[model samples]
Target: MSDLKNDIPDFQTIMLPMLKLLQDGRQWTLNEVMRALTAHFNLTEEHLKIQVPSKQMGLFRNRVGWTRSYLKKAGLIQYPDRGVYQITEEGKQFLANNPPKLRMKQLEQFPKYKEWRQTFNSGNTKEKQATRTEEQTPEEVLASTVEELRNELATELLDKLKENSFQYFEKFVIQLLQRMGYGEFREDSTQHTGQAGDQGIDGIISQDRLGLENVYIQAKRFSNNSVGSPEIRNFIGSLALQGVNKGVFLTTSRFSSSAIQTALDSKQQKIVLIDGKELTELAIEFNLGVQIADTIDIKKIDLDYFEE
Candidate 1:
């Protein structure tokens, strides 16, 4: 058993609030819930760790899918379409009646979940059977199917790394950054000369040659905890160490009110903080050694052609 096994309750703690936000008759996208989750909980969306239970290995997609899978299995939620999730009647009823107090071991207590699992397994087999009958090229199928598998695996990776601390997580992010072409990036772990402390600057990356320019980064892996101004201030101080003026503060958790204010207040320093949410988005954007798992093509109608 690993740390995440023990941190299951923490993941549940997040999932409960997530379910509540969807209780209304509104459909929510994954990004929407992620935003609400980050703001409400003060977590970083970009982080593989705090974004969900499994993010570090870049398994963001699957972790989210797994959460929905668990919720749907427990009759706590439903997926109306790709990337869109809504609460079901049973899910609403369960919430109203039970008011989820999540426990890793207690997930099995939901009787509806067990029944749902039986039906779900049955349906999955039927779907597989139907797919087997479809006339499709093996290569074509492999291309698309491989992507889906990759996406699922990415989510799982993130979930597995969620329980690690900031120190360890920093190494992960640094590696990720280096893959994105940050060659001179190295972790800063101590104080230097006057006004040259390591504060928020956990790692430094040289952007250009001549050793004249660099980007400082601050990585934080928090456990359901919010980072405050002090951390930010220290990071700003670190920027001055090598005479670098620009910095990026990255965190797996979220920032506090003062933290955001501090960044905005100090215009001269030019500090950019990439919290968990943004970090994940960048990883996806850069394709920083991460493979794409799926691409769902949704067809929409041209109304003019169908006009009577």
Candidate 2:
């Protein structure tokens, strides 16, 4: 059995010790701090060798990096130059008044840390609940938080998509398909037909840049009512009139079981369905009808490049 004490300390567990290392009011390089922390922890040789799953850096070092980053974000430390940092006046004052040991809850006293925690807590309810528990690993908590944000964004996207007119929705679908590498140019290979007197087909996209093969589209802006088998049948009839073998039916609502079965049973023509949830996911995946608000880059050491 593995020794429980050998496990990598979480970032919160390192916060207090890390802060104390900088309490002497001297500037420190990251490497110097890392070395001091290794001695501070009194880690065994085996513990020092235990690396993250990626086999890049030791697990303990990663936690130290995260601890330092969080402290900086909370205004407890300052990075005067690359890889060099020093405790701030507020951080020194905090250490002077508090006990040598620090914990996550204690860090909430800082306004910056409190604001960061509040933002994190505002995630999906499930994620918020997971965050309150200590049983999960740090990686698990991060993954859950990301998934919750995605769910929230997808919901918002679907809600906005439903508010648009059917003609606009049709145009949006065509634009999305073009972004996904279908139809090289909008005017040449994609066209919106969600106008009065048109059949069930709303738009069309060419499979090839030359516009040889085409895929018909039927876009519906719905809220509560589910797309049923009869609606799918009407779409199939429209495809038949156009002598098309492939068709895509998109709705800002779910498809009923019968509608799904009907589409599967069609032997002559192929019909692809995109319900509200899937439509929004595709929109996000292809970077269509949405913009990236922020980006975070998670980096790991490249061990092989540095090997002798």
Per-model lDDT = 0.60, 0.78
Misplaced by over 4 Å in model 1 are 1-158, 165-167, 179-200, 295-308
lDDT by residue for model 1 (1-308), tens? 34433333344556677778898958899889766765765534344353332333434433455566667656667666667789988767757876646533445677655543332222322134336646666665556554444434443344334555556677667767776666644433221121234444566666555545666677777644678999888777766665778877777556888999999988668987776555655666666537664455647899999989
RMSD of each: 17.5, 14.8
Best by lDDT: 2
TM, every model: 0.44, 0.57
Q: After superposition, how far is residue 140 of candidate 1 from its true place, in Å?
A: 24
Q: How displaced is residue 223 in candidate 2, in Å?
A: 0.8
- Which 10-residue span in candidate 1 carries the lowest summed lDDT? 187-196
Evaluate candidate 1 by giving its C-alpha RMSD to the native, one decimal.
Answer: 17.5
